[model samples]
Target: MIRAVAFDVGETLVRDDRYWTSWADWLGAPRHTVAALVGAVVAQGRDNADALKLIRPGIDIATQYAAREAAGRGEYLDESDLYEDVRPALAALYAQGVRVVIAGNQTARAGELLRALDLPADVIATSGEWGTAKPSAEFFARVVDAAQTEPGETLYVGDHPANDIVPARSAGLRTAHLRRGPWGYLWADTAEAAAADWRIDSLHDLTQIVSGAG
Candidate 1:
């Protein structure tokens, strides 16, 4: 029986591609170029922060784009804005009595993002705070501890196979791979081929997965 469900915030629960795309457009570069740059940095075995540093030159251009949006009185480009797109889905899980927790890596601005999205204060657990990142057993262990549930009793849903599924599985948590785009090779085939404990195409499918687990 699943007692708790932890989520990867970026791309899994929320869509952050828009931010990256917007940044790319502002820099007058192909979106794929920016993504490729990010991929290369991460491939070097750098942490998210280190990867960001490698991409900072590009990110500064993106920040300038955000500034332009802010000047135009457009919706502010906030990291938390990603969560707004998935609030209803999250609320649905909460209504179903699932204890939802976020296990992510972020800069110190994470709290600001959460507040901006009006996310409840209790559901977040981050690498910045925990001093560890995914694919690390210690990171998932903190999530298991925070959720107050044993590994076998929890389900971890994430977008990345290496960062999300592999680590959670290592921690003995049931894994769900959220099929979105070309983010991972696991999604290149079908969800079944990915071999996650569960595969979901949308957040709406999560409740049914949990209910069926019982």
Candidate 2:
């Protein structure tokens, strides 16, 4: 039985259109141009951070992130940024006495942001805080440890198959490939993604999927 479920943040619980658009605006680049690069990067199984550097050559990433934070506007996401399927799906899992965690490659302020949004999760972790990112065995091991469950008892749900599903499965967690975002749909037929225990069109389908998994 799955005792806990770990989720990816961007494109899984939330759509980051406004967030990326804000970044593009700050960097003085066309939003559509940056957004296309982002999609292309994910499609090619490259890191989003790598795409950022590619988009703006010779820009210091840390300095850029700091600048965005210092501005205090468009640096954080709110309830409006979340997917319609997020709240209900999380609520349903909570009602089942399942331990829910939001574990993803996110900024240092992600915990504070999620707190402000009042997301329904027992624990929220960001790679910046955890000191490791997805697709790394160490990170997934840490996530399972944080959940206080054996890896086999944990289920990871995310849109990114390479970072989220494949690695989590390798770390011994069952995986659900949620096919909602560009990476999700685009890589749906990939060998790594196809290995997920379950694949669903929406997060709302998670309630039934989790229940059935039990």
Question: Which predicted model would earn the best lDDT?
Answer: 2
Report RMSD (Å) for each prediction in the order shown. Answer: 5.2, 1.5
The 0-to-1 C-alpha lDDT of every candidate, in the order given, reads 0.67, 0.85
Candidate 2 per-residue lDDT, tens place, 1-214, comes to 8889889998999888877898788888899988999888886768776767877888898888887778875467788899998998899899988899998888778767876777779999889898898889999998898878999889899988888998999899989998878888899888888999998888777777668752
Provide TM-scores for the models. 0.72, 0.94
RMSD of 1: 5.2
lDDT string, candidate 1, 58-172, tens digits? 5563366457567663223354446443677677778878788877765334534554666532478568678887778998899898778899988888877778887788789
TM accuracy, model 2: 0.94
